[model samples]
Target: MNLLWLAVMILALSIGIFLFSLRWIRRWIREDIQRRQAASGKLNAIFEWAERGRQDSLRGLVLPGADLRGADLGPGQEGEPGADLSYSNLRGANLRSVNLRNTNLEGTNLEKANLRGANLKGANLRNANLKRADLTSANLRDADLRGADLKGADLWLTSYNSGTRWPDGFKPPMEAIRMEEE
Candidate 1:
């Protein structure tokens, strides 16, 4: 009689553990599904906002490390090139320490932006409004700045190579500038 009772207790304990484990597994699955749903909703919103180029309203809405490469920001004119910005407004945006090699920035407004320590090698800045932009320690090697407004733009400690193209008859400011050997 005692042996039978012990066996029954053991079976009950095993069943209890199994039931608890199943509940835990279900909870984990439910949480995972919820997380995926939330992520999907956020992605949908990002796409909607990017498609419209809603710059002024994207201050806090743009996700971190957003991928906006090859996105067309707006209409381009003769001598101006268009490109994808990857959701960076860059209006007075601090691009210091950022590498933007070969990225298109045609007709983007970069007025008063801080581009210190930025690398714009082979990037297109055609017709970009860069008035009063701080480009200290920036690398503009091989970048196309045709028709870009550089009035009062700081080129302190900036690097320029022979491949870098400047606006018609314009040269990089001669203040603490470096020229790369061809």
Candidate 2:
């Protein structure tokens, strides 16, 4: 009878321990997920604030070398304001090696911006002013550049696939063509 009691106690203890451990693990995972979500929300808020400042004609809004992948920087739609960087002065900004895929840059002034090795795949740059911008070795695959001004811009070794659209009658440099071939 004593042995039987001891066995039953041991089994109950083991079950209690297992249940507690499982509950603790689940709590830890939930807390971790909440923490990550908070961080993401903070980052998005900062981006939105910066966009607002830029829209208010605040010059030199520096966001160079920022990881802005999948960020919506387009004009507002359906009463919701998106990030519109149009007419914003971004001269001499360091945007090197950043992912700007699918970003909107219509009519934005990017004069003398350092966009070396930046990935601009599928980005909309219609009517954007890129005068004297340093685009050395940048990836512009499938980027739309209709009506964009590229006067005095350096296109050295820039890569553009077949889907890339240039301004009307604009000719790509020899290096760009060679990069596409390779």
Question: Which candidate leads the pack in TM-score?
Answer: 2
- The runs of at least 3 residues in candidate 1 whose Cα sits more than 4 Å from the true structure, single-residue gaps closed, are 1-83, 86-89, 176-178
Q: Per-candidate TM vs. native? A: 0.53, 0.55
Q: Model 2, residue 125: displacement in angstroms? A: 0.7
Q: Rate the local accuracy (lDDT) of all candidates.
A: 0.67, 0.70
Model 2 C-alpha lDDT per residue in residues 30-142, reported as the tens digit of each score: 99888667656745764666566425322223443233433434333333333445565556666777555655667777778888887777777789889999899888888
Model 1 lDDT, residue 39, Cα: 51
**Model 2: residues >4 Å from true position, as ranges?**
1-84, 177-182
Clashes of 2: 0
Worst 10 residues of 1 by lDDT: 56-65
- Give one digit per residue, the lDDT tens place, for model 1 in 1-182: 99999999999999999999999999999998886676567556645654654332322222222333333333223333233553334565545666566657766677777777777777778887788988888888888999888899999888888888899989767773657764
